[model samples]
Target chain A: MDLLAGIFTDYTLRNVALGAALLGLVGGVLGSFATLRRQSLLGDVLAHAALPGICLAFLLTGTKAPLILLLGAGLAGWLASLLMLAILRSTRLPEDSTLGVILSGFFGFGIGLLTFIQHSGDSDQAGLDKFIFGQAATVVGEDVLTMAVLGGVALLLVGLLYKEFKLLTFDPAFASSLGLPVRGLGTLLTSLTVIAVMIGLQTVGVVLMAAMLIAPAAAARQWTNRLSTMVWLSAAFGVLSGVLGAVISATRENLPTGPLVVLTASLITLFSLLLAPERGLVWDWRRTRNNRRRIRLERLLLDAHVLYNHAELTPESLAQRRRAAPARAKEELEELAARGWVTGRGERWELTEQGHAEAHRLEQAMRVLPKALNPRAEGGAGGAA
Target chain B: MSSDFVIVLTAIFVSTASALLGSFLVLRRMALMADAISHAVLPGIVLAFWVSGGERATAPALLGAAAAGLLTVTLVEWLTRTGRIKNDAAIGLVFPALFSLGVLAVSLYFRNVHLDLDAVLYGEIAYAPFNTLEAFGLNLGPESLWIMGGLTLVNLLFVLLFYKELKLSTFDAGLAAALGFLPAVLHYALMSLVSLTAVGAFQSVGAILIVAFLIIPPATAYLLTQRLPVMIALAVLVGAVSSVLGYVLAILLDASIAGMMATVAGLLFGLAWLFSPVGGVLTARNRRERQRREFAARLLLAHLAHHDRPVPAREVLEEFGWSPAFLAQAQQWAQREGLLAGDPNGLRLTARGAALAGERP
Candidate 1:
């Protein structure tokens, strides 16, 4: 409750939270397209590549103005993306390697410029290093307002071109066949993503900013298959992590806001991977286990029905026919008995009406849907029995 | 030794060590693993220093880095094996998280220590001459030089000894495994060396420069060569050259040495991307253009050969629906090649063109 009050009453906290929220909102919405396009690593390249641009913007403008700096960042990121795509199209280098080259190359150039600026003794560059790892605590009303305007534009464009972006992401060749401006839409999408990265630089910085664009969207992917739901959920996850991370960092003296936000987003991704309803790893394991058990129970029922038809329903005899110990057979009988599928005492047993009907149903199911009914391919043995 | 000489030597040693192992990485299409490992090794370095009671010990640091590298590979592999995420996304996810944790650890716990964040990103390559190693009361040169030199030797020996195994497993893991070579074990061994190299270079050239040294050289060599041996040798050469040039440029411009090294390496890659005769962008484009023109000439000659009499250029356009510009280019090419002899008013296939067109069917 106190934290809640601080969010509204505390000026610095308010700005940090607002800035982080804008980053998350924009990153998540555009990141959905990035992730779906299988270009998750592109975000990292673009963010790293934006550094030199930011430094150049500072050097040229001689000011730390947020809007101008981001413009520089956006332009550099845009150029880097164009170069990456061109190299990918024209060269034999793999995507990852091409991205690595641009990522480290541009970043190296940026670092060189940063060191040069420092050596020049420019007092205006006091907080420039903050852009490297980001200093969320330094965010003020102006930075937040700039982030809001840029993020709002990106979000509005994504909303307007929703259908075209979807078609482009899922099947570019098909979209091209439909006479859509496939290449234009793709370039526009990347440009919007560049805008997203630009807004995020002041909050998450370059190194961890890719996670802001990837983790939320990746987590949302586990929950839904539809692009619209995924985008909305991704944005929500991004905002939650961003706001929570900013508030926590503001509360803690040493914790940095960007990393804290990334850690929170990563935690969400890990949680979704393990616990989401349909696609979660945990649920997948459960479904497979239950399936095995169902198959076992059905096979046991069919085996018992066969033995009963042969007038040999004793535990010892049933055990011999099923190649199991008499003790194991007795255990199996008790389980069926608990379910009221069989009636048994000591050594002899008989199938109940429900058991008989179930066995017949299984027999019919196997005949009609052989593959689905018999995953283990033990149908021949069951039929012979 | 002059500090400039030591710095350049340290850069060269770091580059050589990274480029050797990075060749195999690029071949295996695991180039980004270099980036991932370099970033992920930060926490290991921090933990090593922390556990050593604030002393910088080489053994603990290397061990920690190797463990961290292995952990990164295992996590990425495990994530991919879950079938929930792709290898690239797993890498994109794991390294940043580890890196963030490392950054947070530094700010939170080691704020008062000498291991500041800036040093981690831009290691004191400029100050390498002062950080010397002493043994048996004898003064050794810069410690980073020794570290990087030793790492380069280890990588060189590893690549030499396991040349066959590395080659087999890298190109065709299935075939290598079928022959009981245990490619998986070899892969881990290679990743461990890459980790150790990154950590060793981490203190001298910083993280991002290490990535440049690892990827750019080998990638440049890849664009220029197909033979693995030639590729490895060329990568080391490029790395060495980049380091020297980058150091000189850094001195002239008064910029960060390691950053300039990376910048030079990038410049070399750009050169290779544009001009390498093997699979270069311009060369491929030229080849494609030549093929298109040659085929158009052949088609034009065949069309002329179809007629016993001279066919007017207008008749040719009406029948084949050729763009006027394209047809003119093709006709000019044919006439130059002696495959056709005609003007726009009249066109006929030469004897050479008739023979060439006869071979088409």
Candidate 2:
């Protein structure tokens, strides 16, 4: 309870939560475009390649200011993306391989440079290594301010060009024919992604920042089909997960904030995958079951109609015709009778006029289904099946 | 042997083993999976050690790591099979969770142990020479050398014995299955081989940049060559050179050997990307230019063959709207080939040029 109270009133906790939330919002908005384009791993590549930039920033500036470091990291990440695009255009190697090579190559160089700095006897190069997995607990007021200002600008850009980006994501060739600079817009979008990743690097680190960028967007994808809804939902989910992760970590003695936030986002993804209304697994399973029942009921009605048109039909004969058990046939007859489609079900069953009409429609549908399926069997031979 | 010799030899073996396994992985388009498997094997190593009553160096840990590799592949395949996520996203999801689990375990349960995270990231190859192998009371250089040598041998044998199967499965799994060959088996075997190599190389290159040795050398070779055998050979050569050069650079700068090696590998890949002779960017453009010039020359010769009247060179350029450079190069090439003779203001096709233009493929 005190933790909850601290979340509302505590200065440090509030700042950390706000910073995390700001990053989450922008990451979520950008990740929708990324996930839709099947370029989710671009986040991972950019984050890993930013390590060298961070080290370079500190080495040159001799200061560990968050904004300066992020500027360096963002520029490095942008350069990596450009190099990646060049390799793809120039070579036949797939994007995945190019991403892996740049990620490790740049990161390895960063580590080498960092080790040199450590050995150079600079005492203040202490917390620079935390970019590996992030340490969100170390976030301060100035850091939050930096994140909000940068992230706000990015979000505003996304809002201003939402329709253009939407067209760009769905169809690039069409956008190009309409006189849009497809490649330039693509580079701009990539630059925005780099900025968003840079904003979250200090709090989430390199390894898990990829998760933050992807998981929220992926989770929101399950509940939506429209691009606008997806972007907003993703941003909402990202903020909630970030703030909750921060507050929860604050409760523990020494739990890592970054991974915990990622874990929370991941849990949200798992739930959305299984529980969302339209695309969720639970909904799909229920839909399939209902469809099965409807199909079986129609089959029983058609079989009963063919057995003995206007006369009463015995359940045993109906079962024989259906190749099903007698008890199962009797229950199906009872269900039809209960629904007023048939009447007087027992050892014998009689079809109502509605039931007879339904059976005829189903019989006609079954006859046309084969002809529709086999286009070669068009014309008067539709009933041959 | 001197310690420096042992260090370089160990590095060579490590690079060769990884580069060989990585060749198949890269060709199969599973380069990032090596990175995932490398990270995912951490918990497997830790569990194997903890389960075997604190036995530091043994076979169970290796077995556990191999199991982890197979498990990583299985889980990734399973996740992708669910049809909810993509292959890269599935890879992104699985590795970090497992790697983070491994990290949390180290911090929670094994804090008192010597499994430092730094060693996991940047391996201390400097101490590898000190851990000498002992057999029959005679020292056998670094233990890493023997392990990596055996690994390279195993990989070589696997490639030699199953060369046909690997090739067929990699190129066309459906056809392999139609011919009663099990592509899945070869895939699992390759995964196990990659896992074992990754575990063995960990002491030399650490977990992070194993992807570098696994990818960069083979990728560079891929850019330079088209044949698989030659590609593999070139990858091994690249790896060896990168190892030797990186060792020298690292010794000079007193930096991590693995990092320097990775940087060197990246540099080599960059060079191959820019300057490979076979269909590389630089060469491909040049080839296109040459083909265009030859084609223009043929067109000019054919044009001359159609007319007995003297035609001004200026007319050809104005008629075709060809670039001045292209027209001049075409005329010069035709003249040199004896296809066309240039007069003061016009060109004419010779008898040979007429005969050549008369023939059609």
Best by TM-score: 1
Go through the candidates in order and give each one's DockQ: 0.62, 0.43
lDDT for B301 in candidate 1 is 79
- List model 2 lDDT by residue over B1-361, tens digit each: 6767877787788888888888888888898899888877777777676687665664777787778877888988976786777888777767766666666566556655322455567765321211232321114346667878899899989988998999899888899999988999999999999988887776555776678888889999999989989998999999999889887887787777778888888888898988899867788888888899899999888887788786887888887899878899988888788888767758888788889988895
lDDT of 1 by residue, B290-347 (tens): 7887888887777777789888878878887888887888888888889898755588
Query: Where is model 2 chain B poorest over a 10-residue stretch in terms of lDDT?
Result: B129-138
TM-score of each: 0.82, 0.80
**Per-candidate RMSD vs. true structure?**
6.4, 6.4
The complex in candidate 2 yields a DockQ of 0.43
Q: Which residue segments of model 2 deviate by more than 4 Å?
A: A9-11, A282-385, B53-57, B112-115, B125-141, B286-361
Q: Which numbered prediction scores highest in DockQ against the true structure?
A: 1
